[model samples]
Target: MTIHEIDKLTGQFYECICFKPEHYPKYDQLQELFYGDGKLINGNYDQPLEFTVQSYIQAIMHQIDDGNATFYSQQEISDVTEVFGKTAQRISVYEYSFTAENTAPWKRGVNYIQFILVSGEWKIVSMLWNDEKEELAIPEAYLV
Candidate 1:
């Protein structure tokens, strides 16, 4: 997929499962666009800007436990948005889940999402799923 596609797709994904706390930063950026101050954004997006060595791994553990997720490819680094300004290409492997009768379990083997940088941050713009025959477009109204 093209860089532009990845950006749009990631934006859509953020819009989708946004009720999940970990995804809050994506909307935080959007709020920054609407509000003159970053206070509202900062207050709402509560992930800390830094972490200690052990806390860093702990954070990851906490995230996975809470269903914090990301899409990446085995062949490339997922564009988590580099702190420095630079563009890089990566392969894709998308993973998300569907709610079951009483709970939701992570669904694997969806697609490889391609991402790109816009305004100095990386955003998913496109998805290349292995199951091309059953691809789904996340609805805008579905986002909270």
Candidate 2:
């Protein structure tokens, strides 16, 4: 994707996570890329991934139980940086994370995430992370 296109798509993704109240309206679109073609699953190897996706969504919603959902809105967006080159299609992987002040202590951990250009827009396609441990370390560059 052109830098401009990537920027626009990246902004949309962040906005959806941060400020959009109509979060579920785009659920199908979001899931299509992340879970499409059974990509989130592994008929040959890993366990079914539907549970993972459901659990992930549930964890975020748990923040809403105590009125903490707005932290997503207050999240600091990383600069719109990209590694652009030609491989197959207009694909770029972005890394971003949000640290919630006053988050449930049990929920603290860094997320390694990636998004992809599905048809003409970027969507989160996969994410993996380590468990929350004592002394969770934020990267030096990410400290604001």
TM-score of each candidate structure, all chains considered together: 0.28, 0.41
lDDT agreement of model 2 with the native: 0.42
For candidate 2, the 10 contiguous residues with the lowest summed lDDT are 86-95
lDDT of 1 by residue, 59-128 (tens): 5446656765442111221333222233433333333333223333333332333344566555543334
Superposition error at 4 for model 1 (Å): 20
What stretches of model 1 exceed 4 Å from their correct place?
Answer: 1-85, 89-97, 102-106, 131-144
Residue-level lDDT of model 2, residues 35-97, one tens digit each, is 333222212224533435555556566775555654444222343244444211222222333
Please, what is the whole-model Cα lDDT of each candidate in the order they appear?
Answer: 0.35, 0.42
Q: In model 2, which runs have C-alpha deviations exceeding 4 angstroms?
A: 1-4, 17-29, 32-74, 84-109, 118-120, 129-134
- Ten residues in sequence with the least summed lDDT for candidate 1: 35-44
Query: Residue 72 error for model 1, in Å?
Result: 20
